[model samples]
Target: MDNKIIAILCGLLTCFHLSTAFATENGSDSFSLGAEGIMAGALPPAGLYFLGYYQNYHANKFIDGPSQFYVDANAVVPRFVWMTNHNIANGQLGWYVAQPLVDLKVKINGLNDSNQGLGDLYLGTMLGWHHQNHNWLAALETVLGTGDYKTPSQTHLVRANIGKNYDTIRPIFAYSYLNSNGIDLSTKISYSWNSKNEATNYKSGEYFAGDYSLGYRIQPKIKVAVEGYYFKQMKDDKDNGKDIDFKGQVLAIGPAIQYANKNWSLEAKFLKETNVKNRPEGHANWLKLVWAF
Candidate 1:
């Protein structure tokens, strides 16, 4: 038994242990679901815009196997977008960046741990088009492993991690159809390709996630909607070249409302998860504010 081989085996076990302890079967990736609700696919006109998001996520149950754990997490993210006047493929070109500050707490097996720090950095480029009653957007986004992270030891007892400590590249497509009668249907879908974590030698599976909204305008500046998000891992996670049977999936739906004016807009939603598998069954409250400059 070589020392290097033993060390590698220990690392893989620690990786799986940490994932199960955190209660996220996919091992906590950088993409956070339920971040977009109303007007999810609509891109603003050419200008600089600022968006702020606040989310409180609470979970008391973990499905798939019997588990006694609860998680409470809060995130505050600030994003900036510059929609340039330049055109690409007959659409507007946009660039955006987001940074998140996260506070996370977990109680598993009567042991408590917490972490508060910066999460991953997200940046993307998008091309948007608006024609008559249709809106379309395509984006290439990347999540950088810029947050605080450490590999847990073989003991598997470690502090809660707020970052995935890996890079992810996602391709997103969004569409919105707003009719003359103030009815709107919008959706944004994305696929993620994850890179291996250098510290743990683990690579998370690919994921397919989407957000959808259906709304009816009650006033010129207000709308009421039902919004939701869906997530599923499309591939198996890998640890040290061995496949891990970790397939996480969830669906959440809730009511949403938004108010918009010429300069700014605010939207809020509460999503309750259902049909969860290999993940935490939880609800999230999200509030988003966007203002144009």
Candidate 2:
């Protein structure tokens, strides 16, 4: 069984390299941030696992405004995970609070000043199952949010994930929905692999194009890591007046480094759009921090 796991990991690593080669040929510098907070757990435990994270986003185009920018600061406290001792099955229940504080210095080209506020609030939860190999895992999760934003616009989300690990290689696939007044579907796949030199101290791995990362353990008290990812936009309902649509999709990527210990941790990542679909004003970066007990 161990040998089989090792083989899978090795195959995954090779695929990672091959994917990178293909991405390079496409001339796409797409990148993604490494998984952050406790969602990036090494393995599932049998007891209650509590996790939380805070992310701040600065964007010029959250909607269809001019060069407007806003900071979205969100925190999820005590998101809980429960795993049965049997290991074949597990469940997760969690909630999060998000607030988008906006500062629109440059009014959109046409929109009025009355179309602004402190942003909306959001909350969510999930459930999952584990495979017997200790290498494969899968789950389904749902999230909903309400507040002033719920009036004209509300947030609803549902997602499914399948992930596998082989020794030092891990790959994840997820399908998600962001439904407010309009519905948005997002599909994403990512992989991570440990570097060849075990003694190098940093676990180096690369995901699609710009999604490369390096992680190092800082003794008993801390660990530091850095990573990046690419953002792409799919088709939306701009032509169909029934649904909400933005100018265009923006492609962005950035690097982030983090420090963490047993009781607490801090993370900071910067993201910028490399590709602009239709909206040029919708480009910005952000930073985030998290804590747990």
Candidate 3:
């Protein structure tokens, strides 16, 4: 019968590309506060929503000592969403939360460094499965500390996403893992679990990341994206005894632009670190702004 109808249409197109890569690995960026889609356009039973953002960072290391530029002023950065849709067990469910409020400053190697504090708080969830044209997603996220002032030392994240929605364009892939513990501020110490000395009690360590995205809408509101990210940092019992080895790696690439309607939305992003290891003043650059309801 025509070769069994072309082998059942090539096995249903390879299960629809593995269910859109597992719905873009579970859709993240912390509920779209980071932008790129996967929050189901603002999930929930369809009620209560909010978002805000602001970010900035600059660096220069043509060959110097330290100093890497920094600036992050956040105001009312918040997000909360919930959505549900299950008709006879078809699929659709999501939840989200986000918070930000920080002010930072640095000059490095030349002196002048400051940190106001309050950043890092997120929670997310998603589940989708409905095929008629396309639909398949799975996601999970976490990063909570409930910041108030000095933050860092609160980490927990898990992700898996896969997406495919063609009509305009939607491509996503993600994999994430993070676990942090190490913070005891007295004076000079930021990130890397507060410069671990033994990390006295908070015992710092953990990081593993991955990201990839492609979204283009242009019309239905507007969308644009290009992203890449990778990070690794995990090795500390105080590094066995410490001869002199910290272990770090980071790579970043970016370009993002978004605009939405139905309520309000606007976003911008730019990241470039190319590649870095051990810490070359940790090259960096960032910019962000978002608002939603």
Number of residue pairs clashing in candidate 3, backbone atoms closer than 3 angstroms, sequence gap of 3 or more or interchain: 16
lDDT string, candidate 3, 10-94, tens digits: 0000000111111111111112222332122222233344544444433444122223322222334445555545432454655
lDDT against true structure, model 3? 0.34
The local distance difference test score of each candidate is 0.72, 0.29, 0.34
TM-score of every candidate relative to the true structure = 0.90, 0.45, 0.24
lDDT of 3 at 6: 5
TM-score leaderboard ranking: 1, 2, 3
User: What lDDT does candidate 1 reach at residue 5?
Assistant: 7
Worst 10 residues of 3 by lDDT: 6-15
Order candidates by lDDT, high to low: 1, 3, 2
TM-score of 2: 0.45
Say which candidate scores most in lDDT.
1
